[model samples]
Target: MRCNVAPHTFRSSPYFHLTRPLTRRSLKSIEDGLINAQHLDDQIPTELAPGNAAVLIPLANVMDVPGILLEVRGKMMRNHSGEVSFPGGRVDATDSSYVEAALRETREELGIGAQDIEILGQIGPPEVNLRGNMVVYPFVGFVHAGSSHSDHTNTVALDEPLPSCDLDAIRRNASQTEVDAVFHLPLSALTSPARLRASMFRGNRPYWAIGVQDLVSDIPASFKGRMKQIEHDDVDDSEIGPGKYGNLEVWGLTGWYLYLLMKKLKLYY
Candidate 1:
């Protein structure tokens, strides 16, 4: 199937684009900025293991509204039940590489075929949750423009409504699960100040916030109320409420990956 998403306007912020090529001096400057900003914590022990996993960050083309595709797992699933995440799983013996595993699982979960996706690059190898100490390799892939899939497919028909939006789906999915929900947040969100905030959590508690940019001022009142209700419920369970304007406080491995990616790309605002 061909992905037929509309084209969304994406601009590179002046803050994000460096004037010169990244040299050792420039790299050191960037690292120093992060260190001085107190964003680096070297105390956490690095846990590297052999288990492999993968996830596809599916991008849809929408006019002035590029978005990432995200899935909400059935609550009955064994691990990360009801969590909002990218469609992926552990590497099977038949899978040749982590990239292959990601593409295959995305095909299985979203009815997105291997031929329809263009692999961009990788982000990180974070720790996996349920698979007895497995490392997850996340790859960025772009769904072919104008691609279309049917409702009759086994994947889309079984999963709940697959939302494609600018970071809103991430917040909504995380709010529903009350656990660390995986997300491929847009680079645009990290460029604005009003849409971003820094959060501090209890000792070693992973916490970071990714604010949304260019949000419509008049969001439907009903949707706003529903979001409040979801936040209230999550708060009762000791999880942070859905953040301002329905943005999420990314935590755990998700937050770590985002942090690292932002640092590496020098894109954080």
Candidate 2:
């Protein structure tokens, strides 16, 4: 397995609020400045791992607020059930490039077509998932829901604390067998220092986690029945609220990648 990147330094910043209300323009400003990950020497080096996979950090303007798109794997999924994640999966043998593999997974998992996504570039310092015995490559891309796309709904997820978007039409293309719900998290919410923290998993391995504070109810019923774990940190985080409760944290590889992405944009709090 490849070595992991050391965690970046976290510092208090008076400049945090200035990035809000994150907009298309502000994110686009740094597009050209980002490191270019794809290359003319395009072999995926799948030899580095027994398996290969890719995921896209989807960027979109949902409800006119620019943010990242995420998903919850179906309850019946073989692994990582009820967890929030980006749309992607294992790289296929026929896949010519990691970019294509990432695009295909997004289309299959979210119904967002390749044509709708403008590939920004690949994300660097690829992750090696020892449990899966594979290398996972991530890419940054922009997604534009066309006029034919379903009407937008309010976003949901701990990253931005949105209720799940339930637009029927927009999800027509998504493979419900694999995906339980879709969410668009505002960049500002993800960058909010109050929502982000460092935590230990199970007991020993320390990882970064984002606190949503939403109850188990914020997620789908299917996920609720299959739920196996609940974790909450932060004294200020509420434990009880009406019929709805909160606290779906993002940790492990997902949290790490989010840190890397947000750090790249100078949005990490």
lDDT of each: 0.45, 0.57
Per-residue C-alpha lDDT of model 1 across residues 109-169, encoded as one tens digit per residue: 6656777665645564344453346656666655543233322122432222222333443
Once fitted onto the true fold, the runs of candidate 2 whose alpha carbons sit more than 4 angstroms away are 1-28, 36-50, 147-168, 200-208, 212-218, 226-246
Q: Where is model 2 poorest over a 10-residue stretch in terms of lDDT?
A: 235-244
Instruction: Supply the global lDDT for candidate 2.
Output: 0.57
Residue 244 lDDT in model 2? 16
Question: For candidate 1, what is the lDDT?
Answer: 0.45
Model 2, 1-269: lDDT tens per residue? 11222354454332223334333343344455355323443234544232678889887665655567777777777777766777787877767777888899998888877776766656557666646477778888777556221221222221332122233444566778887777666665564556655554333434356664342224765556544433344222111111112345665566666666666555543
